[model samples]
Target: MIKSWLKEMEAEYRIEILFASETGSRAWGGATVHSDYDVRFIYKHHDVRSYLSLRKAQETMDFPAPYDAQGWDIYKAFHLLQKSNPGLCEWAFSPILYHDCQNFSSKLRRFVTESYSLISLFHHYIHLMDRNLKDIRGKAFTEKRQKQFIQAVRAFLLAKAIILEQKVPVMALYSSFSSSFPKDCTIVSFYQQLMEAKQSGELVSYADIEDAIFMMEQERPLLLELSYGLSKGKSIENELNQWIWELLHL
Candidate 1:
């Protein structure tokens, strides 16, 4: 069912990178808990139709249906290919990809294998760090420190992606970049809160976390300098669209 669905999508859109994440891998320390599959794919247009300039005005598609619990996100491929979007690298090795067709996706799988923009990924991590801090410090009605920790790990890895590789690395954070990253107020604040949580041994949902979240919200705008123009990734090859056309019987 998954492969066929992906194939059908390939026939419809020129898929550049298809990533599957949170499909739940045993090696990742995911317990026997029933986890939903989060599937995200990025596609690009071969024709002139992709340049409509309405990038955020619904040039993409997202749906959730027909599974134990699954998500489908279809993006304009050209949009993400530029600047080595971390989302592309994150999904490429989701440990649960159903299919990859139209050779375009295959190429992206390789291109990303080589390059990813550190600046853009840093921006992404910054936003995520802010979100985590919000969850921990301010009004995160739910106990979200686990997610915050995950974001911190991601942020740290993205910075290393820049420092070590000059581009975003894959979603899985390796030990190579795990030790440290550039820090700001929110980063330090989140770290401090995490330490407090560790020392107090209190429940994760403890109300004392709001301060960190508040600081993160305040520090959100500081990361804009790192994110600008990170989306303009590599230009698409003409052959990739030709492949899509062939698959579509055009």
Candidate 2:
């Protein structure tokens, strides 16, 4: 269904789809049965003249629908890549691919993996985890709150990976990034149970998981300390330009 939709969209807009993938909870391997598909893609104009025109081309598209879909123009995607945007990095390395024309995603993933800024990704996850932590701390427990708590945990794990591993966290399973944590720790045990509960449609209150939340709070300082030792990555603009040339001609 998604592939057909992409074909239709490509034909209609006269754009070449570089790649498309599942994102959000499903891409992270943390989604429940009720989770919706979040489809994102990268594309470029089929006509090279569009790049030379005086009028600005649309850099993004958000479609309403039977399928939740969005897209970024390749130029905009490379611009964000140069800035080491964590969201773009995730899309580049997303585990589930719906479309990958001429292995475009693989090429982009290699660039992102090698050159994405450590500090950018580290702080991105840090801010994300912190915001969700606030929600978990202050909000009344409900299904929405439970989702927020899960989001916080996922962010914490990814942030922890960035600071310690010094690499893009691309694993589909967020729990798989727990190598730094102790093998039999409360965090690990709680995460496993929490995932099972979420998948089973079980309702868990804030009180039920308060200790684990505190554990995450206590570890925040250590992550910051590790982040201090990270190096900012190099520029990929020249390489991205080469990609633009090659992709345009292909």
Candidate 3:
């Protein structure tokens, strides 16, 4: 079904998909049985002339309903990559690949690893956790919304891990938490319960995540200090341009 849909998209848009994969919970290894496949891809147009026009081609495409499908144009993806866009980095490194141009994915992965900004990814995870926490604020926590709480915990751990390790956190939330916090810690057990609940399709109602939250709060000031001291990294535009030329067979 996914392959057929990709083919249909390629024909309809006159674009070649260079890389594609499953993202979100499924790719991050915290998915419930009911989780949906979040398919994301990077593609490029065949008509290079269109890219040179003052009016740019649409950089993204989205399909609603039936199955969630979305794609980013290669040009836009590369631009984001240079800025250390966390979403693009996640998509590039997603564990569950659907379709990928062998050379392109590998090259992009290496570029990201070399050029990634610890500060940028750290901020990204912090913003994600902040937003999730805000959404749950002043609301009554219940069994039905346990999934949201689990996600919040995951985001917080990822943000904390980025600062403590001075690197991008692992894609899997469980691994990120384990690596950051000791195995025998109560917080680890708390997170483990949440993970098991999410995977087993059970509600993780009202976990005592206060300790985790406190740790993040204490770490925030130090993280901000480190972020201010770091550089945003250099552009890989020349390399990306060459890749684009090769991909278009120009």
Candidate 4:
């Protein structure tokens, strides 16, 4: 179904989708039975002449649910890669893939993993958690707020993995946490319980997430210190530029 959707999008937009994958809860291993598909993709113009335009073309497309399709132009994708954009990195590492033209997805996965800045990626997830937590603060535990809490939890864990493990965290939350902190089964068990509550339509207790956030907050200084101690990532602009050219013109 999603493949056909991508085909329709390609025909309508006259672009080649080089990579497409699931994002959001679906990709993160926390999705419930009612979850909608969140498809993210990267594309290049089928006609390279579009790149020669004086007026810039739109570099992104966003469609509404149930498909909830969104994509970046090749240039935009490369720009995000250059910044080690955590969202783009998740697309590369996503366990669920819909398209991977010319093995572009694997190429991107390896590139970001090898070159992403530890501090940048770590800070990205940390800030993400903080922002989401702020948005839900003083709010009732409605379904929307419940989702936000889960996202915050996931972000906090991912950031924790990055600083402590000195690696780009994996896309799936449970697997990433379990693998990164194999001895710490308590947090993993708590996460499982949280997910069960979420899936069962039970509003998870606010205190549960609050405690987790408090624990994460206590580790911030150590994570920051560890982040700086990790290697500064290499420059990837030249390589990414070359890769983009190949994708668009080859």
Candidate 5:
């Protein structure tokens, strides 16, 4: 059903969907099976969509999914895909990819370094951390909500690494109490004990704030440098995108 949706979209509308995420991948790695399948894409229409404004007509298709919605606002897709957001990069690297006819996914991969902004990515992770921490702390101290805390801490830890490295860190491993980072550094080990929690669709709690705090202190300086350096003049736009257009279009 999903495969045909791609052909129909391309055949009928000339719009191309670049990527999608399968819900199952999360399940195998500890997420609930009921997680939504998130999909995203980029497309172009017969030239008009490139410049149309509020007063002008638009070409976009939005439809409901079993667990989510699907649609495309053409230009927004173009810009965001061009910039290579981390979530989008994950979409490219997604184990279960939906469509790749135009070869945009691979091309996008080569240009990702240009799209990354340490400050922007850091803020994204920090906000997630704050929310997850609050949720865990709000719950009564018990093992019931352990899974949520674990997921939160893992997210926080990855963000912490990016802050430390001043780069978009590849996602790390996770369980209820402990998590690992890119290349599998076992900074914590109790993450291995969440097998039962995993089957029950749960996460572990993180009452130990010291590890997270210490990691942050060591990482702040690098993130500060990145934040201070992201300027228009410093944008590596031409070199990065040019490399993409010339090299990876197959």
Candidate 6:
């Protein structure tokens, strides 16, 4: 179904897809049975004239329903890459690939770690955590209402890892925590239990947010402090421009 959809998109858009992958909860390995396939891709056009005008070409495309298929133009993707965009970085690291050009994805993955700013990535995750928490703030934390909490936890954990390790957090939640945090930590134990419950189709509530919130509070200041001290490295626009040209000409 996904492959057919991608073919349909290629035919409709007259662009060649260079890479495609599953993202969101599915990519992070925390999806439930009801999760939707958040399919994202990168594509390019052969027309050099389309990019030269003052009016920029559309940099994104989206398909509706059943499966959410969306894409970024290779041009826009590389532009965002220069800014250390977390979404692009996550897409590059996603474990579930529907379609990929090995050379393109592998090179992009390498570029992401080297070029991405730890401060920018940390703030991205922090923003996500803040947004998730806002969704459930001042509300009753019920079993059915645990989605926001779970998302908040994921974002907070990622933010913490990025600040402390001074690197991009792993896309997979379990792996990220295991690699950056202590094995015997309370948060890790809670996350493990939550995963078990999630897999069993059991409801997870806000009953266990004490440790999670505590950890977030503890790490918040450190993240802010590090963000101020760290320097965002050189922009990758030149390298990205070269890559985009090669793809267009290929």
Best by TM-score: 2
What are the runs in model 2 whose C-alpha is more than 4 Å off? 172-181
Write down the RMSD of candidate 3 (Cα, Å).
2.4
Tell me model 6's lDDT, rounded to 2 decimals. 0.76
Model 1, total clashes: 21
lDDT of 6 at 123: 81
Best to worst by TM-score, what's the order? 2, 4, 6, 3, 5, 1
lDDT of each: 0.48, 0.80, 0.74, 0.80, 0.51, 0.76
Model 4 RMSD in Å is 1.9
lDDT (Cα, tens digit) per residue for candidate 6, span 48-118: 77778898877999876758878999878988889898888888988888888756789988898888888
Worst 10 residues of 6 by lDDT: 170-179
Model 3 is weakest, by summed lDDT over 10 consecutive residues, at 167-176
lDDT of candidate 1 over 7-73, digit per residue (tens): 5665776543344344332223322344344556554444445444665323555547543323232
Best by lDDT: 2
Model 5 C-alpha lDDT per residue in residues 99-155, reported as the tens digit of each score: 664676676555554466656666666666667667755457455456555555455
Per-residue error for 24 in candidate 4, Å, reads 1.7
Q: Between the candidate structures 1 and 2, which one is better when assessed by TM-score? A: 2
As a TM-score, model 4 comes out at 0.92
Of candidate 2, the 10-residue stretch with the lowest lDDT total is 171-180
Q: Report the CA-based lDDT of candidate 4 relative to the real structure.
A: 0.80
The C-alpha stretches of model 5 lying farther than 4 A from their native spots are: 9-14, 21-28, 46-64, 67-74, 81-84, 140-150, 171-196, 202-250
User: For residues 1-250, what per-residue lDDT tens digits would candidate 2 score against the true structure?
Assistant: 9899999999999998989998777876668878888899999998888888998777998886767789999999999988898878777777889999988888888988888888878888888888987876766777777777777777777787676567777652333445656677666566666767777888665676788778888998988888987768899889999998998885
Q: Which scores better on TM-score, 1 or 4? A: 4
For candidate 1, the per-residue lDDT at 242 reads 58
Candidate 2: clashing residue pairs, number: 0
